[model samples]
Target: MKHPAFFKQFLITICLTFFLAPNLEAQTKRIKRPKSSVGISSVDNYVRNSFDLYDKVYKYDGYAAAGTPLDDDDIDVLEDALDDLALISESAPDILSSLDGQNAFKKAKATLQINKANKALKYSVKTAKELLAGEREREKDDDDSSESNENSDEESDKNINNDNSNDDGEEEPSNVSDGLEVYSKYDFVPGDKILFFDDFSQDFVGDLPSKWNTNGSGAIVKLNKVEGNWFELKAGYRLYVIPDINELPEDYTIEFDVLTSGLSNQTSSGARLHIVLSDTNAFSNGKTHYAAVTLPLGQYAAFNINAYNHFNGKGGMINSGLTADIRDEVKNQPHIAISVTKKRYRLWVNEVKYVDIPRFIEELDVLNYLKFHLYGLKDGEERVFIKNIKVAEGGVDLRRKLLREGKISTNGILFDSGSANIQPQSLGIVRQISQVLMQDESIKLNIIGHTDSDGSDEANLKLSKDRAAAVKEALVNIYNISADRLTTDGKGETQPVGDNGTTDGKALNRRVEFVKTQR
Candidate 1:
C-alpha cells in the first residue's frame, strides 16, 4: 500500500546499502593500534611520508629535469641518491625534511665526488704495477744477452789457444792447410787436352769472374798459401757455382778432395767441386746441357745431368732444381768421384757409392761441346778447401738399356662440352702431366685445347680458350707449376681426335694434347 515515489526511493536505498556494506566490513576488520609515547613510533612512518613527497617532485620534474635523456652514469647516480635519501628519511626524516632543497642537492653532489675519487685511485695503482712489471722484463732480457756473449767469448778463446799450441810442433792436417787429392778413370778422348787447374784457385774475387757465379749465400773461391805438401784452395763461402759452360764431355770421370772448416745447419743448395762441361754458345742462346758431381760438404754427394735452355733474367738450374743437404760427417773431409758415359752417371763419396742414376746420360744429351769450371757454395763467411782435381772417362752405356722405359705414355685428359671448367675427376690425368714435367726439367710442353662440333665455331673457339685457361690455372695455382714454363693454346673444333658422328666420337673430339716443345 506504498506510493510510487516511495517505492522508487526504497529500491535506490537497497542498491546503495549493498555496495557500502563490504567497504564498511573491511574497515572494521583492521587491528586497533597501541598508543605511542614518542609521537609517530619509528622511522617507518617518516619514510612513508618522504616517499610521498619524492613521488610528487619526481613526477613534476620528470626525473630531475624535463625532456632530459638519462645516460647509464646519470641513472646510477640518481639511484644511489634515492637509496641514501630513503635511508636518511627512515632514520632522521624530520631533519631531512627541515633542510632546504639546495642543501639536499649539495649532499648528493658530495657523495658523487667521493665515489669518483675512489675509482681514480684504483686506476692509478694499476698503472704503477704495469710500469714495474715492464722494467723487470727488460732487466731479464739484458741478463740473458750478457750470458750468451760471455759463452761465445769463452769458446773463441779456447779455439785460439788450441791453434797456438798446434803452431809450434808438426801441425796436424788442418782444413785450411791441406790440399785435396784428385784422380780419374776415363782416358782422355782424341784432340782433348783437359786443363787440371783452370781458375780452381781464388785468382779473382767479387761475383766470380766470367763463367763462375754463385746462387746462395757465402759463395767464395780463394787461393791459400801453404808449406810442404799442403796447397790449400781457401773457399770461404756458402754456395758458389759456374753457371755457363762452353764445352762438355761425351764420356768422363771427375775426382776431387774437399775439406770443410765448418758446417752449418742449413742445407747446402748444391755445394761441391764441379767440372761443368757445356757448350758455351748453347748457354748464351738458352740451349745448354751439362753433367756434374755435386759434393755436399759433410753430406752425401750426387751426380746430375741437366739439358735446358734458360733465357736471360731467368734463374738457372742450380737455383731452382738442386736439392742436397750436406751437413753431416762426410762434409768435413770427403773424397768425391763422378764418372759419366753415354748411358750411365755414377758418383762415389769417400769410396762409398752414393748415386748410381743408371742410363741418366741417355735421358738428355748433356755432353756435346765441353767447358770445365770449379764452383763452391758457403752460406756465410765460412771457409772451404778443395784439392786433387782430375778428369778421365770409362763408364757403362745404361741409356741404351733403358731406351724402352723412355716410351712410357705422357698422354693427358680432355675437357667436356662447351665448358672451360676442369672436372674434379680429371685431377688424376693432370697429376700425371705434372709428374712428367717435374721428372724432366729440360722438357718444354705445348698444352692444346680443343672442342666438339656441337657448338658454333665462334662459341667453340671461346670455349676452347676458357678450357685452356682453366687447365693452366689448375696447374699453376693448385699444383704450384711455374707459370712461365707453361704454354697454352686453343684450337676449338679445328682439331678433333675422333669423328663427330656419335656421342663417343663427339667425346673423343673434345680433348687436350701435350706436345713436347723441346728434346
Candidate 2:
C-alpha cells in the first residue's frame, strides 16, 4: 500500500530510532548475566550485575529519539526495582566480609563501589546527592570488616539468646529499660502508662511510616539482606514527630533501636541525630523553645536546653558526658533508652549509661511535643534508621508510688509469649523489689497478674494466675523472700489499664502489680 510522504518519513525515522537506541534497548531488555570476573566472589558478582542493571535504566542513551519518556507508573516500577538493588548493595559488603579469602579486600572494594554506583542512580537530585555524599564519606568506614569487631552472627545471636544464662551459674538481674538479660547494667524503668509505641510492623514496605508525621520525607524499608524494618530518613533537616506527646508525665522513659547506614571501616562521620522536646505541635523553621539530645559521630551524645549546649558550653558540660563512640560496626545496632523524672534525665545506649542529669528540666514546664532530627549531614554522611520506639511514664521513687498509691504496677516483669515462665529479663525489677521488701521485713504484699483482652477469657485467666504464681516463686526461690510474706491473685483481662486493641496498650495491660496488704 502506498502511504503519504510525511507518514512514510515518520515510519522510517521511528525504525531508525529503535535500531540505534542502545541505552533504551538495554533498559527494556531482560537483564544480561555479566561474564564472571576472574576470582570475583559470588556476592560481589551479584552486586556488580545489579548495579549494571540500574545504570542501564537510569543512564542517558546517545540517540536523541532513542527512548520513550517514562510515565509516572513506569517511573514507579523502575524506582521500586532500583530500591531493591540499592538495599542489596548496602548489605553486600557485610555478607562479603563474613567470608574468608585473600580476595576479601578486593571484594570489599568492589562491593563499596557498586553501592556508590547504585546511589548514583537515585531518582531525586537532592536524595541522590545526600545518599551519594554519604557513600563518599564511608570510604574510610569500609576499612574495618565485621570480623574485626569479633562479633559474628553466630556469636551475637548466641549472646542475645543466652543473655539470661550466666557462666557463673547464678541468676543475674536484667536491665530495667529493655527486657534483655545482659542489659543488667541498665537501671531504666518504663512509665506506669504507655503514651506511644511503634515497631513499624503495620506499615507497608516502600511507604511512609504509619505512626509518624515528618516535615520532610521518609520511608519504611527493610534492607534486602538485613533483618527487621526501619524508617529511613530521605531528606535533610527532617523532623520525625510522634503525635502523642500531648501532656507527658514528669517521669517517663523513651526507648528505640537505631543504626547508621554509612558504617564502613570502623569509622563513621557526618551523621547526626537529635531528639527534641518543645511546646509547639510542629517544629518551626526558626528558633523556638526546645530541649534536645544530640548524638554526633565519634563523640559523646550531648544534651542541649535552649542556649546551653552540653558538649560545647560550660553549662552544657554539667549535664553532658555520654560517650556513644558509635563506630566499629555499622550494622551492630544499638538500643537507646532515655528516662526523665521531674528535673532528672538519664540515657542508656545498649547496656552502658551515656548521660545522667539530676536537674535537666529546671521549672514547672512540661515537654508537650516530641520530635527527632537529623542534621550536620555532608555529601556522604550516613543515613539513620530507627525502630521500636516507645515512651512510658514513671521511673522515679518506685517505693513511694507503691506506698502512696496502695499498689505498684510494672511492665518490667516480662514472660514468654503465652507462657507462665518468667523471662530472665524480669529479674532486674524483681531483685529491686526484693531488696525493698528486705529493707522493710514487716511489710506484707499481694502480687496480682493481669492480661489484655485477647484470646479466650478462661485461657487468659489461667495464664494470668500462672504468671502471678511464677513471680511469687521467683521472689521466694531466687531472692529468698519468705513465702509467708507474699500472696498471689490474678485479674486476667477484667482489670485492664490500657486499650486492648493497640500493641502498646496490650503490652501495658499485661503486667504484674504489688498491692500493700494490711497485716
Candidate 3:
C-alpha cells in the first residue's frame, strides 16, 4: 500500500512483471527515467521518451559490464522499463533509431551516443532478465522449500515427447552451440534484397507483434530458460497467423528459428508446425493454390510438403527408419530455411534439405504472402515458438555479376550492430563469392564492408574494417580461399545507399561488396 518515489517527481517508466511468473513476482512500480536531449526527428516528445530508456540501459550496461549486480528493487524497475521500450519499438521501430541523418552536424554527434546505447541495451537486457529470473526462483523457494524438487521434476516431464529425452528431470540448456561447418553442404542462398525481417525485438514480452495478423490468437513471449522474444502460437484447425509482407517476388528466400517447449510422452503425433505460402495475405489458403511445408514434432512422424488442393510430396521418419534424436532439435532450437525460385521449391531444417522439388509450385507468380498454421496441439500443454522471421528477394547468381559488372554488393551478408562477428547464416553469399575464385585461379577480390549511420564515424570505420577482415578470415579458413588473393577495406558510414531514417533503408546501407581486382 506504500511506495517510494525516487528522483523527486520525474517518474517515467515501468514494465509489467506479470509475465515473470513462476520465477519473479515483483510488484509493478515506476522507474526513474532520466531526461535526454537527443532529438532524433520531428517528434521531439517521442524521441525524448525513448532516449530516457536508452539512458537507463546505458547505466545498466555499466553495472553488468563491471560484473556488478543491481539491488533487487532497482533491477525490477529496469525490467519494467525494458518491457515498456519493447512495446514502443513494436509500433515505431524508426523511433528506436535516434540518428536519422536529418542535420549533418547534429546527426553526427547524436549517432555516436545512440550507437553505444544501442549496443549496451542488448547486454544490459540479458543481464537484467537473468537477475530477475534468479530472484523469481529464490522467491519460489522461500514460498515452498519442501515442494521444489517435486515441482521441477514435474516441469521437466512436460518438455518433449520425441522419446529421445528420457524422463531425467533436467531442463534443456539455454545457450546452444550449433556450428556453421555442418552447413558446408547447405546451399540455401538468401535473397539479395530485404523484404521483411522481424526478430520480434520490437514487440513486448506478452503482446501480439505489430507486423502480424491472425485469425486465431498468439502472443510475443520471453522465456526464462532461453533468450530473445518468440511468438507462441495458439493451435486450431485451419487457423493462421500471417506476417504483413506485401508480396513474394519470383525468387526469394525465407529463414526463421523454431523451438518447442512443454511437451511430454503423451504428446500427440498429429501436432505439426506448418508454414504456408499463399497468394492472399488474409486468413484463407489460396482459392487457386498455396504451398505448404510441415515439420512434425513426434518421433516416427512424417514431415510433409504440399501445393494445397493440388499435390503433396513428403519425407518422414518411421520406426527403424531414422537414428538421430528428433528431440534434440526441437528442444535445442533448429533453424529452418526455405528458398523458392519460381516453380522450383527447396526447404531445409538446419542443414538438411527436407524438400527439393523441381516443379514444386504449379505456377510461378501465384504465391505472394506468408501464413503459419499450428495443427493438432493442446494450446496450454504443448507450445511452439518462432523467431527471426526473415523474407528476402533475389537469390540470383553472383558469378555473372562479378564478371559482367566487375562488382557485387549484397545485403545478404550480415553482422551484429557495431561488431565484427558475422552471422553464421550470412555465409551463403560468401560461399557463392568463393566459388568465383575457385573456378578461375587468376581471380582476386577486394572485400569491402559497410555499415549504417548508427555509431560515430571513427567507431563505424574501425568496425567496418574489422568486419571485412572477419569475412576474409572465414573465406580462407572455411572455403579454403587463399589469403594472398584477397584484400580487405571498410567504407564505414561514408557511402549511403539508403535513407538512415527507415528500417529498409538502413538494411540496404549495411552491405558487403566484393570487387574483382585487376591483375
Candidate 4:
C-alpha cells in the first residue's frame, strides 16, 4: 500500500496478459500453410485464365467462322492440333505460378484453337458425307435408267407377242396381269398368339444382329436403295440361326420376308433357301434331328420337304416328292409363310401354296430351333436378305373363341392374291363355322372382312366388302347356312392387330372375322 496508482496498473497488466496470451496461441495454431509449394487459386479463376489463353491461341472465335478450305489432308493437321490442345488443358492445373502467365495463356489459347479445329473437322466430315451420298444416288439413278431401258425392250417384245394373239385375235395375257392367278386357291393363315416377332428395327447397322447368330459371317446391313435393316447372309450353306425362343405348340406358324438379290436375272437358274427346324436347342449339336423345307427361288421354283423324323424310337431321313415348279415368286421381296399343325407342315410363297407335307415331323415337341440355310450359292454370286421373322402359336377353336369372346377373328380364311374370290381351301374353315351354327340353331353371325394396308383405302374397303359378301354367299350356297341369320360388313386396312410395316402384320390384317350377333 505504498502507492495506489502502481497497484492498479499492475492488476490491469496481469488481466491483459491472461486474455492476450491464449488468443495469440490459438491464432497461430489456426493459420495453415498449403501442403504444396505452388500457390492455389479458385476454380472460377482457373477457368477464367483458361478462357483468356483460348482467346489468344486462336485468332478466330467459334466453329462456323469461314476458315481456309480443307481437304482430306487437312484432317491430320486439325486432329493433331486438337490432341495438343487437350494435353495442354489437362496439364494446365499443375503449372507453377512463379513463372510469367505464359503457360496459362498458352493453355487458354489452345482451348480456343481446339474448339475451332473441332468445328473445321466437323464441316470437313459433313462435306465428305454429302459427296458420298451424291455418288450413291447417281449410281442408283444410272441403275434405274438401265432398268427402264430393259423394260422398254420387254415392252417391245410383248408388243411383238401381242401381234401374234390367239386364233380369235385376243391379246396374249401378260405375266404381270396373270401373276396373281398363281395365287388362286392360296389359303394360308398365321397361328393365334404371336410368340416372337422382330423387324430388326432395334439393331445397329454394320453389326451382327443381337437376336440372331450364324455359323458363317452375317451382318445387319441396310440396302442403300431399300428401307429397313436386313439380315444379310454372307455365303453358302451357312445356318442363320434364331436360337430357340419358345417351345413349339402343337399348331404354330412361321412367316418372314425374303429379298433375294444378286441374281443375274429374275429367271436366273440359281436360288435355293432351306428353312430347317431342329429338336434341340442348338442346331449344331449332333443330337439334334431337323426337318427342313427347301424352296428354290426365281421362275420355275419348286419346293420339297426333308425330315429326319424319330420313327419307331429311331431317326430316319424322309424326303417328299418335289413339287411342280410354280413361277418363282421371289422377284424383289416375297412373304414366306409356313403353317405347322402337329405332324403336318404347309408352306406358302406369297399367296401360292408351295409345299404341303402331311407328315413332316413325327411329334410337335421335337421342334425347337429354327434356322435359315442358304444353298445354291454360286461362288458368292447371290445375296439374301431376310426380315420380319414372326412365330406364333396356332390351333384356335373358332367356335370356342366366338362363344367365349362374342367375336372370332381369323386369319385362316384367305382369298385370291388381290381379289375377293375366296380360296377353295378356305371352305374347310367355313365348314367348321357352319357345323357350329347347325349345332346351335339360335346363333346369328355378322361376317366381317378386313384387308392389309397394301392397297388404296377405297379399293381395300370395296374388296373387303365383296369378300365378306362372298363368305356369306359361300355359307348360304355351299354350306347351306341360312342367309337370314348372317350379316356382312367390311373394315379395310383400318384396324390393325400388328405392325403394318411387317409382313406378319399384313397377314394378320388380311382376315375374316365372325362376330356373334345372337347366341
Q: Tens digits of per-residue lDDT for model 2 on 1-519?
A: 222463344445544544554433222221222211212334444545565555444332212224443333433444455566566556655654534563433333444434443443342232222222221112232224323322343343334334433343323322112223343334566565677877676789888877677777778888742345788865365555444567777778887777666634333244557677665666542134455676654322222222122221223333354544544212446667788777777776666666776766554354666777776554345567787787877665577676678678897676655667564434657766777788888888899999988789998998899899988887887678999999999988999888888878888899999998987
The number of the candidate with the highest TM-score is 3
For model 3, give the 10-residue run with minimal summed lDDT.
314-323
Span of ten consecutive residues with least summed lDDT in model 2: 130-139
- Model 2 scores a TM of 0.55
**C-alpha TM-score for every candidate:** 0.29, 0.55, 0.61, 0.48
What is the alpha-carbon lDDT of model 3 when measured against the actual structure? Answer: 0.65
lDDT of 1 by residue, 1-519 (tens): 224464344334433443443322110111111111111112223323333333332332232122233334433343444444445434552433433433323333222322222222222233222221221112234335535644554454334324422222322222221111111111211111232222233333433333333443323344332211212333433223433433445565555555555454443534444444443333222244444444444333332322222323343433222344334324435545566665565565543455566654433454543323223445344456444344433232322222324422111232322356453323444555555666666765667777878769998888777777777777776566787777888888997766676443455566666666645
Clashes of each: 30, 16, 3, 7
Whichever of 1 and 4 has more lDDT, that candidate is 4
Judging by TM-score, tell me the better candidate of 2 and 3.
3
- Please give the lDDT score for candidate 1: 0.41
Cα lDDT tens digits, model 3, 262-357, are 765566777777788777877866555677767667644333333332422222121111223354456557777889888787877666776777
Q: Scored by Cα lDDT, where does model 4 land?
A: 0.57
Give me the displacement of residue 71 in model 2, in angstroms: 65
CA shift of 155, model 3, Å: 16
Q: Model 1: which ten-residue window has the lowest total lDDT?
A: 27-36
C-alpha lDDT values of all predictions: 0.41, 0.58, 0.65, 0.57
